[model samples]
Target: MTAMHHLTTPDGIRLAYADTGGTGRPLLALHGAFGRGRPFLSLADRLGPDWRIVAPDQRGHGRSDRAADYGREAFLADTATLVERLDLAPCVLVGHSLGGLNAFQLAARRPDLVRAFVVVDMAAELPPHDSDWLDGLPETYGSLDALRTEIEARVSLGEPLHFLEGAVETDQGWRLRWHPDDMREVKRQVFGEHWADWYASDQPALVLRGGASPIVPDDIARRMLDRPNTRLATIDDGTHDFYLTHRTRFHDAVAEFLTTL
Candidate 1:
């Protein structure tokens, strides 16, 4: 069965997600900072019938609760709670950007809950991409298309949105679902600490980077290769949003990685 719904977190916060029940290993897919899990529906479809996919809309995204103090730990804690609540056995966690960092943190803290990790288009350490003013962006828009056009036009020139997949329309507007306040806090937490220095996961981890993304430097990607059980790959014609911009190549990399596990 295919379903999209909401689940309450440890602290009673409601988080939204998409769940597809099937036969193989259980896979949890987390979206980027200002992202919703639905954007990954195409990926889940292409993965075939071998896997059950669970894609969660981060705490402040999609149809979930929009509360204050929504930061990295809140999202991570909520993910851990969902895993325990659903009892996703032999789970393989797949994540992108901010989601990648949460996956690493979860595996590091609760190693037994995770079998492996697919880190998509995110490095342990990423340089800033002029995302500072994103929080202050106005939520009010005259029209949905106008909002999307503005966002797409503005973000296309930036580092991450240059590679996003499809856009969705909402009652408020057609902009990305990410809550601005939460987004600001999420960025602060992600760049606040050096990832390599803080992350310690022994499970198999794959780091996929976008060949076209300027946010991740070659040196940083190279240094990430030094980690144990961690291999690296790059997707051409893709920026930070490789899964959406280059679906076939992205799925190939993930499918190949799953086979090894």
Candidate 2:
């Protein structure tokens, strides 16, 4: 756990973010659904002190207050606000999955705020899916073991622990901090082609895809690099969570991009 900070948006949503405190050049990182800013502290360590990493919990995840909606506009607004309020403009942006879409969308809409961006295991095209997968996910469990059991039984992730990583302990019992309905809404809005948004920004970009990802296919990953000033790298045998599982390789790729900038 590094230094934590909070921001209250114009519409009164309270957002949380983690700052790897230092005078290094700033880099704003965004996590996918069901994630928080705490994970980036380790990423800061890996990327070294040369880049000051700032990660937000986004609208309805982690310590951030839930908003009225989880649509594309809402997510992008929060990110732009964070970067501007924190004086992090012209900084490098990094995101994964849902966060990856947000990163590039923000860059597309506000290129002045982003000097460069990295999109990890996400593409402009996404197939629509239903929220039936979220049925019956309880918010609370009697204990960490209980929580683990339910998540293990119901949810599938790159790692089972990932879903549990954000679980919180409470006086009544253990519970997941994020609301299941919120996640479901986010997922519902995540689908559809975003090629226009993808090519909107001329900013330098890096696209990182897992070699074996089901979310991002080989052709789509290659298409992302079709944009000028964009670079593509695939992590061998990596999954969507390659940035976490294959951290060293992920860092090496990012570090190389940082040098280029």
Candidate 3:
């Protein structure tokens, strides 16, 4: 079982997280964009009682308060505060997509706080896509199904419904937990030269790639191995959201990696 908690950052944002208490090793699980802490409950259960998974609704997402700054450093600072405040330093970090990038960046700068990290389906450098998709999105949808249908039509491909996992249904209507403007800006910040950060840390690491994912290219995934003490694994039929779609397989891989530590 997981317990929910809240903390006020120096910037006064209310960050929310779920802590699955256990007698085993702690794993800080960071979800990708449009994800929240609640879903880690499924992962914690799947990993069994051998692990404590702490997942947070990052700044401007889920139950957390919105932030004016959506840059990489801002995200890093939020993760740092959660780690230090929860006394989770020297623990493992398992992040997906945007969360994965945040994990490695933190490990690079604060090795003292991170024992090891797992990057799931995220490349050091993000691939670019058109932002026109968000140009005319409505502020709210009449219902969850309505939002899903609308977003699905616009997205055309990939996991469009995944975005609804972080959506909020208020009295007004169903809307994303975060603004499209924030997501767009953050996505923009993600596309850049990050090879330096990728190679900055020598900490033990595991890079899990989705076999069917178009996010992390083969060349970059192979280059990721050049960093010392890193291993790469792939889930053959997996896609970017394989962790959710293939929980058992993802859990097995994560469990196997923990044994090495």
Number of the top candidate by lDDT? 3
Score candidate 3 by lDDT: 0.85
Of models 2 and 3, which has the larger lDDT? Answer: 3
lDDT to native, each model = 0.73, 0.84, 0.85
Better model by TM-score: candidate 2 vs candidate 3: 2
lDDT of 3 by residue, 10-109 (tens): 9888999988877767889888876776765677766778777899998878889988888999889999998899888888999988899999999999
* Per-residue lDDT over 32-81 for candidate 2, one digit per residue giving the tens place of the 0 to 100 score: 87777666567677778888999888888888898887899988888889
Supply the TM-score for candidate 2.
0.96
Which pairs of residues have clashing backbones in candidate 1?
none
lDDT of the structure predicted as candidate 1: 0.73
Q: After superposition, how far is residue 259 of candidate 3 from its true place, in Å?
A: 1.0
Candidate 1 structure quality by residue, lDDT tens digits, 152-192: 65574334442232234657655555656676777777774
- Give the poorly placed runs of model 2, Cα more than 4 Å off: none
